[model samples]
Target: MSDKKLALVTGASRGIGFAIAERLIADGYRVVGTATSEAGAESLQTKLREHGDEHSALVLNISDSEQTEAALKALLSEYGTPFVVVNNAGITRDNLFLRLNEDDWNAVVNTNLTGVFRVCKALAKAMLKQKAGSIVNISSIIGTTGNGGQANYAAAKAGLEGFSRSLAQEIASRNITVNCVAPGFIQTDMTDVLPETQKEAILASIPGKRFGHVDDIAGAVAFLASEDARYITGQTIHVNGGMNMG
Candidate 1:
C-alpha cells in the first residue's frame, strides 16, 4: 500500500465537492475526485495534478449501480482503499410539492440519498477490513429547515443524515466514522444564478449577511475526516453561517 493517505470525493468537478478535494489534497492526502462526464473529470485531474500524479479524477455516475460498482472496484484494485470518502454528488430537481412530478422526486432521491448508499456500500467492506476510515456525506440546510420549492431535495438530504448516523453506529466499533456536513447557502453554481432581489432577501435572512465561501464547507469536511475528530461520529457539523441555528 502507498504510504500516502487516499481520499475519494464525489462530484468534485466543481463547487463544494471540488473545494473539499482541493482541501484534502492540501492536507496531504492523495485525492481521487469524481465527475459525471469525461470533460469534468479531465478538469478535476488538471486541477489536482498540481498536488501529485496520484491525486486525480474519475468518471462516475453515482445513480447507476453498475457504473458505481465498476468505478469503485477499479479504484479499489488500483489504489487499495480510500481512507476518506466524501459523498457529495447530488442533483437538484426543485419544484413545489403540488407541481413536483414523480420523476423529479425519484431523480433527486435516487441520486442524492440512494447514490450515497450505493457508494458507501461499495466501500464499506474495505473500510471494515482496514478498521479505520472517515465518511462524510454532504447534506443541505433545506434538510432541516425545509424549503418552499425543494421538498424533494429536503427529503433526500434529510435521508442522507439519517443514513450517515446509522452507518456511523454500525461501523464505530471498527474505528470507522460516518458524519455529515450540512451546508447552508454557500456560493456555488446553484446559488450564483439567483436574481439580485432574491439574493438580497437571502442575505438579509442570514445572520452573517454574506454568502459562505466553498472553502468554509471544505474546512468543516476536512476536520471531520481527520484523526482529531476520531471520537466524533453519527453527528452533523452544520456550516450554515447561522442560517438555522439549533
Candidate 2:
C-alpha cells in the first residue's frame, strides 16, 4: 500500500498484541495480525475495520509447525515480508511447581519459546536479504524475576530473551535488531480473569499503585520497532509499573 514499514503481530486479536497492531497502523504501517481461530481472525478484522484502518488478520496457530509454516508462506506470498515481527502468542498454566504436570509445562514452553523460534527462523532469511528488520518479542517480568506459580511460563519467557539476545548478535551485521518487551500486570482480558483477591494482591506490589494499560506496552513496543530505536539491540524494555526492576 503505502510502502511504509510492515509489522506482523502474532496473537493480535486482543490484549497487548491488539494494542501494538493499532499503534502501528495509526503510524501508517500495513500491519497483519494473527490469531488462533477463524472466529478470532474474523473478530480481529472487524475490530480493525471499525478503526477504519487498513490492517489485516490471519488465522495462525504458532505452536503447530505445519500451521505456522503454511501461514508464513501465505503471508509472504500475499502481504510481503514484514519489516517488523512481534512474537506475542503465549499461554500460561499456573500452579505450584510441584503440582505442575508435564503437559502444562510442555504447552507453555512450546507456545512461548518454540513458537517465537519458529517465526524468527522462518523469517530470518527474508530479513537478512532485505538488509534490515526489527524483531520485538513479548516477554514478561516473570521471565527476569521468576514467580512462584509460573515456573513454566517464566522459563519459556526467559528463554525467549536469551534467544533474542543470541539472535540479535547474529543479525546485527545485517542491520536487523532483536529485542524484547517484558510487561507486568498489564490490564488485559487475562488479568481480568483473575480473582479479585489475586488482582488486589498484585496491585499491592506495584509501586506505581496501578496496573499498566495495554497501550503502555503498545507504545513502548512501537517505539522500539521504529527508526528511533535503530541503534538499540539485544535489550528488554520493561513496562511493569515498578512491579519488578532489574
Candidate 3:
C-alpha cells in the first residue's frame, strides 16, 4: 500500500463529488471515489487514473444497507482505513409538502440523511480505532433558507448538519473531526437544466452575481480534510458566494 493517506468520496462520478475526489488526490491522498453504477465507477477509475494509478472507484448505493456495508468492508480490506471520508452522495425529489408522496419523502430522507449516517457509522469503527480522521458532509442552501418546493430535500440537509455536530462531539476526543460544507447555487448537471429566466434570477440574487464552480466547493472540502483545519470541527462552512450570509 502507498504511504499516502487514503480518502473516500461517495457519489464521485461527476459534479461536486468528482471535484472533491480530484482535489484530495492532488493533495497527496490515495482517493477511492464511489458511484451508484458499475459504468459510473469505471468512468471514475478512468478519470482518476490520469492523476495516478493509485486512485480507484467503487460501486456504492448508500440507500442499500447491505451493498453499502459490503462496499465499505471491501474498501477497508483492500485499502486499509481511510483518513478522510466525504459524504457527498445525495438525491433530491422536489415537491411541495402536500404533493410529496410517501415514497418521495422516504427516498430523500433515506438517501440524503440516513445514507450519510450509515457511511459515517461504518467509518467510525476504523477511524475511532486509528484516533484520527476527517468527515465532510455536503449540504445545501435550501436546508437553511428553506425553499417552497423542497421540503424533503431541505429536511434531509438540515438533519445532516445536526448529525455532523453530534458526531463531532462524539469523536472529538479521538481526534476525528466532523464538519459540513453547505453549498449554494453550484453549476452542475442538476442546475444546467434550469430555464434561462430562472438562471438569471438566481444570478441576480447572489452578491457574486455568478454560480459557484465545482472546484469552489471542492477547495472547502480539501481544507477541512487537511491539517490546516485541525482546530475546526462541528461547524458548517457555507460556500454560497454571499447568497446566504450570517
Using lDDT as the measure, the top candidate is 3
Residue pairs of candidate 3 with colliding backbone atoms = none
**Model 2 Cα lDDT, one tens digit per residue, 1-246:** 657777899999988999999998887788888999999999998888775556789999988988898899888888888899999999989999999999999999999999999999888888899998899999999999999999999999999999999999999999999999999988887788999999989999999989999999999889988899999999999999998877
Point out the worst 10-residue segment of candidate 1 by lDDT. 48-57
By summed lDDT, the worst window of 10 consecutive residues in model 2 runs over 47-56
* Tens digit per residue, CA lDDT, model 1, 1-246: 557899999999889998999999889898999999999999889998977887888999999999999999999998889999999999999888999999999999999999999999999999999999999999989999999999999999999999999999899999999999999989988788999999999999899999999999999999999999999999999887799998
What RMSD does model 1 have? Answer: 0.9
Residue 151 accuracy (lDDT) in model 1: 96
TM-score for all predictions?
0.98, 0.96, 0.99
The reply for model 2, stretches above 4 Å from the true place, is none
Q: Sort by lDDT, best first: what order?
A: 3, 1, 2
Q: Flag clash pairs in model 2.
A: none
Candidate models: Cα lDDT each: 0.94, 0.91, 0.95
Q: Which has the higher TM-score value, candidate number 1 or candidate number 3? A: 3
TM-score, prediction 1: 0.98
